[model samples]
Target: DVKVTQSSRYLVKRTGEKVFLECVQDMDHENMFWYRQDPGLGLRLIYFSYDVKMKEKGDIPEGYSVSREKKERFSLILESASTNQTSMYLCASSLYSGRRYEQYFGPGTRLTVT
Candidate 1:
């Protein structure tokens, strides 16, 4: 029973406008992650994808952009919305299964830019 689905929990954009955050994982995980959390510059991993079209770019990833065609779905893009790119946006799902892999979280999407 591993589920991570987040289309939006809360989002308010104004500056520049162009924001889309969506994530869904029904356990068929291969590895998918997109994170952003401020407060001390804590968890900051912008994009990740293990299969389905393939993608990898973590550690901020600038303005942010990501999309996984299938494999449960994962999309996060905010090309213009500024205000230092308001924080708290996280979506993760993992099943690497090599040594250490335990990530399942998607109850976040706070974004507020004005």
Candidate 2:
């Protein structure tokens, strides 16, 4: 089964504190992604990595970054957690077979910046 695991289910961070959220996929998918899900706004991509040690910025990469050091693991880093950054962060992964692959999502990490 394709499974994705997020590091935290919930987080309370102060404004300006660096935050890190980790994710891992057991299925050897080549594309891993970080996204923030908000009400009425839908899912917005934060970053993605296509391969180990390679990364790319996504739609909302501004205060956020990502790392993919190994095939099964991906990490999202928030330079400084802000009140506006508080939201549900989801991690997803998809295969690179050129076929239409649906992303498998994690349980999500709800962050509250105070």
Candidate 3:
């Protein structure tokens, strides 16, 4: 069974504090993505990594960064947490099959920044 697990299901952080969100996939997918889900904004991509140690900036990567040092793990880092950054973070992994790919998403991490 393919599974993606997040480090925390819920997190609370103070403004300006650094936060780390960890995600691990047992399927050994090559493509990993970090997305933030808001009330109306839906899912906005924050970052993605296609290969180990290779990262790419997504649609909204200004205040966030990602690390994929290992093939099965991906970490999303919030440089400085802010109230506006509070949202449900989702981690997904997919194969490199062009045009037809299905992403397996984690349960998600709901972060609240105060």
Ten residues in sequence with the least summed lDDT for candidate 2: 96-105
Q: Point out where model 1 deviates above 4 Å.
A: 1-14, 17-30, 34-48, 51-64, 67-77, 82-88, 97-103
TM-score list, all predictions: 0.32, 0.96, 0.96
Off by over 4 Å in 3: 97-100
Model 2 Cα shift for residue 67 (angstroms)? 0.9
Q: List model 1 lDDT by residue over 32-110, tens digit each.
A: 9999999977898988998887999997798878888899999999888999998889999998877648899999999
Number of clashes in every candidate structure? 0, 0, 0
Clashing pairs in 3: none
78: Cα error in model 3, Å: 0.6
Q: What would the per-residue lDDT of candidate 2 be over residues 1-114, giving only the tens digit for each residue?
A: 889999999999999999999999999999999999999999999999989999989998999988888999999999988899999999999998879489999999999999
Per-residue CA lDDT of candidate 3, range 1-114, in tens?
Answer: 789999999999999999999999998799999999999899999999999999999999999988999999999999999999989999999988666499999999999999
Question: How far in Å is the alpha carbon of 34 misplaced in model 1?
Answer: 4.4
| Residue 16 miss distance in model 2 (angstroms) | 1.0
Global CA lDDT computed for model 2: 0.94
Among residues 3 or more apart in sequence or in different chains, the pairs in candidate 1 whose N, CA or C atoms overlap within 3 Å are: none
